[model samples]
Target: MNTVLVTGASAGFGEAICRKLIADGYKVIGAARREDKLKSLATELGDNFLPLQFDVTQKDAVDNILATLPIGFQQIDILINNAGLALGIEPAYEADYTDWETMVQTNIIGMMHLTRTILPGMVERNFGYIINLGSIAGTYPYRGGNVYGATKAFVKQFSANLRTDLFGKKIRVTNVEPGLCGGTEFSNVRFHGDNAKANDVYKNVQYITAEDIANTISWLVNTPPHMNVNSIEIMPIAQAPAGLNVSKEM
Candidate 1:
């Protein structure tokens, strides 16, 4: 059985991915900061799921915990870099500097650090899959998306560059970008706990769900070893990138 390590597994897409992968018969190590939530998931998932508690934003903690994986779960054949977030939805100049900093630390720095730590093992074994959770915001920008979108764009390009560098060998790198997903803490975090405001973002719209993303991942990993999917972008029928904005003089 192959071992899979997923970050941001406490909730949202990360949580759903863990359940799906386990159901598909793979041992999963779910890493997130919320120990209580991870414990609950472990209870429900039984022995197949290993709950790892640590904030991905902290490189030291991430490195230390992963460095000491137990015997049966040590070799991670698939790594899902799903730990990321978006803060306040204010425009670039009006956005809080601290919020920008937090986004950079978690989305860019943390993901790279964790990947750096794990890539060597995958290379040595001559087999691995690295899937990054990017966003449509990266490909198409919108008001208030600012830094959050920028970080995802970075992810998109980074995945491409990684594939370029890993030209040969069995290792594969893919960037999964989704648009207008709901049923997660995404908007709630961006709105800073404003349930009403967050709810409004998805009200009456058939947005994507965490399960949808998990399904995509399951399919991606199940594909034949000879084929590698470079990138995939998904969006709900109700959502599509609009044309560029225009302004008129008063």
Candidate 2:
């Protein structure tokens, strides 16, 4: 079985993807900051799923996690960079700099650290797949998205450049951009533990589930070795383009 490494594997798309990949016969290294959640996933998924605990924002923690990988598990055929979140919904002018700093650190710097650390091995092997979790906000700016959108925009461009740089090397780089996804911890995290506020965000809109995104990822991973999916953007029908909106005065 091929080996895959997935960050943010405690819940949401990360957990779902790990489950799907394990079912598809991949040995999965599930990394997350939540030890209990990771342990539970490992238990449920059995031996194929290995739980690793670390904060993606911590460079030392990330490096230490990599160092502790089991010998045979060292060969990572696929890397899923999925550990990221938005901290606040405030506009750029009103948003706290702390939130912006957190978003940049986790979404951009953390991703770069892991990618740079693991990419050399892939390059040497002449085979690899990198799947980044981007957002529709990356392409279409929305009110209150502010720095979150900028960070995902960075992801979009970085993924593109990575694909270009790895040309002719049989390495694949893909960006999966999702819009209006619910049934996950995303909004909850965004609202900073305000469950009621998070719930309200999706109450009026049809949303995609974590399983939907996970299935898409599984399909991409199962494609023919010669085929590379560069980018994919998915949204529920209820989620029209960011441009299509009816505003109401409060």
Whole-model lDDT, candidate 1?
0.94
lDDT of 2 by residue, 1-250 (tens): 8899999999999999999999999999999999999999988999888899998899997898798788879898999999999989988889989999999999999999999999999999999999999999999988899999999999999999999899889899999999999999999999999999999989988899999999999999999989988899999999877557776995
Q: Which stretches of candidate 2 lie over 4 Å from their true place?
A: 242-250
TM-score of each: 0.98, 0.96
Tens digit per residue, CA lDDT, model 1, 1-250: 9999999999999999999999999999999999999999999999989999999888887878988999999999999999999999998889998999999999999889888888999999999999999999889999999999999999999999989988898999999999999999999999889999999999999999999999999999899987889999999999987888779895
**Candidate 1 residue pairs that clash:** none
The best candidate by TM-score is: 1
Note the Cα lDDT for every prediction shown: 0.94, 0.93
In model 2, the clashing pairs are none
How many pairs of residues collide in model 1?
Answer: 0
C-alpha RMSD of each candidate structure in angstroms = 0.8, 2.1
